[model samples]
Target: MAFFLILFVLLLLLPDAYVWLSFVRGTSVLWSVLWWLPSGLALAALGAAAAGWFGNGLVRIFFFVLLCVAVPKLLFTVFSLLGRGIGTFVHGAAAAGHVAGIVVAVAACGAFLYGSLYGWKRLVVRQTDIVAADLPEAFDGYRIVQFSDLHVGTFGRDDRFVRALVERIVAAEPDMIVFTGDLVNASAAELDPHLRSLSRLRAPDGVYSVIGNHDYCEYGPHGSPDGAELDFEEVKRRQRELGWDVLLNESRTIRRGTDSLVLLGVENVSRPPFPSRGDLRKAMSGVGAGAFTILLSHDPSHWRREVLPETNVRLTLSGHTHAMQFRLGGFSPCGWVYSEWEGLYREGDRMLFVSSGAGGTAPFRLGAWPRIEVLTLRRGTR
Candidate 1:
């Protein structure tokens, strides 16, 4: 926590200094004060949060305020640097650059506001078709609705969003519903308010889910390891109450007529800095080698790290990336961290689908809008 706080402070200072030197230093006293006042307050909030003086709710508010203040400053700094570099070679370039920076900062402020107010609530549905030679003939044209990274704490007690989401999924009339994970941001209590709304979700086959990194209760204030464990159990119990089959490193077989397919779900798994509790071997123990299988693992990294090299799981579903909740022209900084960040990725006969996520810890989404995925399984080569 201390390391991250220091890093965030450094990030804020760099842009704050750049913008002051380039634009506010020589401006009116009013302009300078206006610039430094919010920056000071943001830093103070950061210190309070790091010192544990604020509660979870206050910390979240501080984070949102920090983003509002920092993002525009960062944008202005980038444009200001470009302008200064150009000013060395061209006349009036620096002045024009300053104007551009201001314009960009204003636009960023508007975008952040809009993203917070409307973008996160604007749920979009994406449809994908998966064709595999190994798919069961009876399961052809099976429509599965996949939603992930719900982060229910973002909604507080409001069931409106979940109700709307459930309505949308029900209207689609999918054969099955699969949730990739991150059902809550930290604790099981977050799921309480939306239990009724979420329970409305139904499918002919069943609703299946697997845990995500956040479901472990380690990211938030759980008091102790025992408390975290209890909270985790409560999360699973609530999901089961909602009629969801919470698969924890387990497999289930779905039979249609004489044809059958395997559905394997594992606990959260990821490379370092994140937890890796999934045991793919254990999940597949009783399954036949040739059975067409769909694996639900929270992190997309698990698909390449274990599934591809070790198992014949034909299709993998995941939702941990969230595209950092920001994207432009099909690109995001999340790509720098996750090789298969969003959308469908295929390697030979195996495939993985990563959702941009239906909800998140922060109530914001830019070009990477919250989404629900409708995938159709077809029994043929594409």
Candidate 2:
């Protein structure tokens, strides 16, 4: 955390320094002094927020402000650098580069502002079909709705979005509903406002959920380790109160007539730096090897690490990546970190679907818009 904070500070400073040297230094003394004020204040607020001096809402605002300031400055620096490099060969290229940098900076500011204000609310439903040769005939057309990473703390007391989300899921008429996790950001209290609205979700099979890394309440400087554990228990208790089967290394069988398929859910599990509480072996303990099984593991990495090699679980649902909450032309920085960042991925007969998540801590998204995923299970080759 300290490394990243220092790196971020440097990123912010380098761009501002470049811009000042290239354009602001020659201006009036007053203009030059005032030029650093916005960046300075934003940095101070962000530092305070990181130190736990501000509430979640204020922290989020400062974080967004920092991003809005840094990104445009970075873009301008890039343009300025290119202009300087080209100036040796072209007579007027340096001045043109400065002009281009200013234009791009303005456009970037607008884009960041729009993303902060409205991008996170642009919800979309991503539909996918999973085909498995061993799927039972009775469960052939099962439609399961999956949503994850709500981070309800980001919503605070606003239940309108949660209510609308419930209505949308109910309208889909799914056979089952599954949440892959991160129900709350830092505390169970964050979910209090949305519990009633979330309780409205229902399906014939059931609504199942598994914990995500954030649900453990260890992300921020909220409290002590013991308090985090208490908050985690409270989160599960509230979800259960809403009629959700909060599965923790457990499996439940959903039967249709004589055919049955196992629905297993494990707690948050991932590589180092993220919590790994899932016990795949315990979760799959009693199941037959040949039975069709679907596993809900919050982190996609678990599918590769445990589910594929150890169990016959044919399908896995996950949603931790959020595609880094940004993408362009089918590319996201998340892919560099997570191989199975979003959408459906297949390897032989096994499949995994990673939702870009229904909500996130940062109230901003670009091309990788927030989404609820509807997956229909088909009993045949696609």
Candidate 3:
């Protein structure tokens, strides 16, 4: 909290400071000073909200506005400084600096606007093939459709988008389907509206799911711990009603002819600070050593902190980061936060696939765009 306060204070002052510098450098004093007002006011509101002077709703509103103003201002300030430095060094003229600064600032604003307006809605399908030497021939060519982090509360009246996503998943005709975790943001009621669209998801091998940290009501604003437990139970019940096999620290087996594959699921597990309720050993109890195994766990960190060193699970699926709902080109901020943030990561014979997630708690997204992942399992050599 203290760190954030320090960072916020710096951001709040930087833009206004840059504006003042611009005026001193012969820009119109009135226009330059006026430009700082929006950024200044937004930063003040954000700081007040962070200090708990305002309510959470107001905090969210102020934050949204702050991002809009602050991002462009920061980009302009940095680029302007660089432009001025280069122009003064090469041409010895301040006008050249001003022109470069203006062009860069305009481009930055245009990029941010485009990302906020359209990138969140640009949906795509990501496909990959995995070859496992231990996989049974009957299970070969098996396709699994994986999606995670559908913070349903954020999709208010976006039912058509939800329906379209489901339609696309079904059209791909996966043999099995898996929802890694995070079906809703905070409350069980959030999933109520999207049930129909979600129910459309179907597969020959059925859909299996595990609870995400958010699904347990850990982030709910209105609930006490006990009330949150009830909400958590309701989430599981609703998932079951949708024909999903909700696994809570348990394992099940799928048979094909004489061979079988182990399907294990552990509750959300992460290092401390994030809840670590999953019990991998308990879930894997009584499982055969020779069979191919796939585990469904919510947070990708579990694969590194627990699964890799403790078990021989061949594949694990997870989604908790949501890639911070922002990315550029193919890189995400999530990479800096987690070792195995997104996409397929392999180590020897084992692999982990982290979905960028299909739905986010926020309506804004950039290059990270939501996706549906289709993974096909093939039985062959490495």
Candidate 4:
């Protein structure tokens, strides 16, 4: 009970603290700086009111924002302390705050606008040919076209981009195509109009997918929000309607004359102690320990925990971080947020590649552009 009381107080105070620090502290000199601080605080209040649920841990982004809100303010304080004495601290701090706000406001706003314009200008389709064999013999050079996070209902509700995205993927004529996850932003309800755009995708081998955390939020009754009111059953139904073979702790085998490639998929995972929804053990149930395998995982951490140590999955494909929806620096941009924001990584014998994702969500992005990837996996003599 005491713990609940303390959390309730923090919940109430977090937003107000943000309000005071943003608007009241800066004296209106920093517009962009003040706007986003409370945007996150507001999101937190909504999340908290929704119960600050942790079944997904996605909502923690708001709290993450609350922490980043202080970065600019703290940067100002540090600059002021460096330049002036104790007597001049207050005045210098205010001036420094105003300056930092303007600089950050311009930088962030510029990047945001640029990203938006970039998203609409053209949604480029990348074609990749994957070859997962060491010798150019069995299945020498294989092509795997990948579609990661398309928040499907994003970028001005534009259907044309989706159509173009599919068109490009189809044009590549990939032997196989896989959608790692984040097929939609909030729910399947927004997908009806976007369905045709999705229908454009076709690969001779097949198109398969795994559920992203967003899908869970929309389909399942969010354990946090109103007892997970989202229609999960409907989400899965829609995935089938779109012609995707959604895999949940399941494996599919893709074949050519005498060779077969195994594709195993599971639910989204960001950190550890994940639920055993289609764990490696069950997915690879009856295979010879050395079967060539490709796992369509939604998060990269799964590679380290399940794929690398436990299973024989040589490659894992995933995309949930969205590079934090914005890339920020040379000094640990990932430190500001979650790990594994973007790109390919290696963990011992296993290889994991994280797509930059395919679209924006909620109309905000910075630094990183939207992307589509073509992974040409060849069996290298490692």
Candidate 5:
């Protein structure tokens, strides 16, 4: 706590310190004071958090947004100014570095503002065609619309935004729809308002889903283990009421005439701290080895840790990472954290597709915007 307090203090004061130094160097006093005003406000916000004046969720969201805006501005301005200061003593190289730093700083600020104001609401459909040699010919041209991480509680006023997303998904004409996990932020109650919209999501082959870590209410308000279990069951019941087939460590065979394929869903299984309820063997128990399988497990890490070496599941879909809600070009800082952060990855004949996710805990997003994924399956060569 002390360490965090010290860091917050530094963050709250650093920009003002830079402004004061600039004022001493003949920058306008009015501009310096104006610049320092936000720092004062941020300091007050932090003090409120420290004093337990704000709700935990509100505090968390406030700090996340505050850091997102302040950190980049602070680093960009501070280092760019430092570079300019160095250029006073050095030569062309330092000046060039300063110029580059300034450009990056401006771009970062612009990106932050655009992302906060627009990116979070902007939804894009990403289409990928997958070829599986072992896929049954009967299932050729099958399309699956997969979306994950709804975190419904975060949708305070995005009802129309969400309804539009649903319409777009339906328009794609998928044979089946899959929600990898995270239908709600913590409890089944979060899905109440959005039920009507969600119920409209339909596909001929059916909508299948699995549990995510958040669905178990482990991160929600503290409650007895029995209460948590009841909430978890309620989530499953809610999904079923919305016409989704909730698969809990189980497999279902989708037959097209004489040929068939397997769809398996395991309860959320991940490394420690994340509940490891998924049992691949149990989920795949009734399936024939020859039948191509599509597995849905919320965390991508399970593919490497268990699925790859232990099973012959041809394709897996996951979405717990959310690419840390940020990415640039093909790069995600989350990539440094999770090897399988987003998009499609392959190993030998097996593949995993990690959606960046459709919703998140925060109201804003940066480079890794929300996605609706349409995956079309093909037979023969991959």
Candidate 6:
């Protein structure tokens, strides 16, 4: 809320000085009649509450019935006037030192609001018609949509944000949805507010999930401890309540006509930042080479080191890095955390797609948006 108050003050005050200095600056008698400052102060309170500084989440959002009304061109007045002096030399830029201060302050505040209030939801659209020869003739052109790393806690939560996300998932219309893991932040309480919205996730094969690094929340060495608020057992129990098939080193088959694709899933044990107790061989021990295979392990590095060369999984899907949870154009999040942070990379004929992730670790997301993936698995003849 302090963040929002500072923002409103900058927007409202800077432009006011400019507008008043101009002829539009009403005379003392004329301006005194309006009560403008009081109105602006009231609006600031609303902004603070909406930002969750002054009230509970429901009081802030997801319970609002009021339509967002248009704001007055409050800041534009000062900026429009200042725009004239910007091209000239910095010294003569403004007659008043306060005007210069206002310009700097306003610019900084606007940038801060956009930066802190926004989040990325990575919607992975997987296209797997890559190996035409490998796909069976009967099941060519199939798409499997998978999204991992929905860290539903302090930094990456808001009803407004998730409500908008639900709309995007519906738009994708995936053939099937696989949640690779780390669905909640740390505890069941963290997910409590957003359960109804997340439950709306739909797919024909259903929403399957695996546990990731943060789910345990220090219940194990692999769990997250950096400002975590929930425990491991509570997280596991809540996941079952939310309709996710928690796959712990297990395999299942999704049959199309007479052909079946072996879908293998495991916990976060085999990934970096965790022990290698995950037995990929055991997960796929009985599966035949003749069957189409899709492995849902939580780390992409698993494929590069162990899964691809050591084993023969055709395609592997994983997500632990939210793409550094920050990326812009040529810049990727890999440098900050995981070597295999985002997008598709291949080793030999095997392919892996690591999603940036759906939720964030904090409330602030500068570059990356939240995610909902629609992976299209087009089976081609290998």
lDDT of each: 0.88, 0.87, 0.81, 0.64, 0.82, 0.62
lDDT by residue for model 2 (1-382), tens: 7898789888888888977886789899998778787678778878676676655776576658666777888888899889988999999898888889989988988887777778888888888889898899999889999999988899889888888888889999999999999998888888888888998999999999999999998756655658878888899999999999999999999999999999999999988888889998899899888888899999998888888887778899999998988888889999899888999999899999999998888788878888989899998987
lDDT of 5 by residue, 54-146 (tens): 433563456454655566657666666777777888877456755676577677777777776677788989999988888899888999999
Alpha-carbon lDDT of model 2: 0.87
Q: In candidate 3, how many Å is residue 331 off? A: 2.4
Q: Give the Cα-based TM-score of candidate 2 against the true structure.
A: 0.95
Q: Which is the better candidate, 5 or 6, if ranked by TM-score?
A: 5
Candidate 1 wrong stretches, greater than 4 Å: 1-7, 21-34, 48-56
Q: Looking at model 1, which ten-residue stretch has the lowest summed lDDT?
A: 50-59
Which ten residues in a row are the worst by lDDT in model 5? 52-61
Tell me the tens digit of each residue's lDDT in model 3 across 1-382. 6797779778866866785776544667777667767666666766575564543344444545555666666766776676667776777545655666567667766765665566667788999898888889999988999988887777765586788889989999998899999988778888877898888788988999998988987665553548878998999999998999999999989888888898999998987677778999999999988868999999999998888998999999999988887888778878888988888899999999999998776666677888899999999986
Comparison by TM-score, 3 against 5, better one: 3
Model 4 lDDT tens row, 1-382: 5697577556545544654664466566575456545555645555554663432234334433433443443444444434444336455655665566557645644554555445333455554444344423555667788878777655435677777788778877777789988776655665777887787677787789998776654432343554333454566788788788888878887777777778888877656433324466777778666678888988776777667777767778988777766665633365455455566676656678888677755444455556678776666553
**Which consecutive 10 residues in model 6 have the weakest lDDT in total?**
62-71
lDDT of 4: 0.64
lDDT of 1 by residue, 182-265 (tens): 999878998888998999999999999999998987766556659878999999999999999999999999889999998999
**What is the RMSD, in Å, between candidate 1 and the native fold over all Cα?**
2.3
Name the candidate, 1 or 4, with the larger lDDT value. 1
Clashes of 6: 27
* Winning candidate number (TM-score): 2
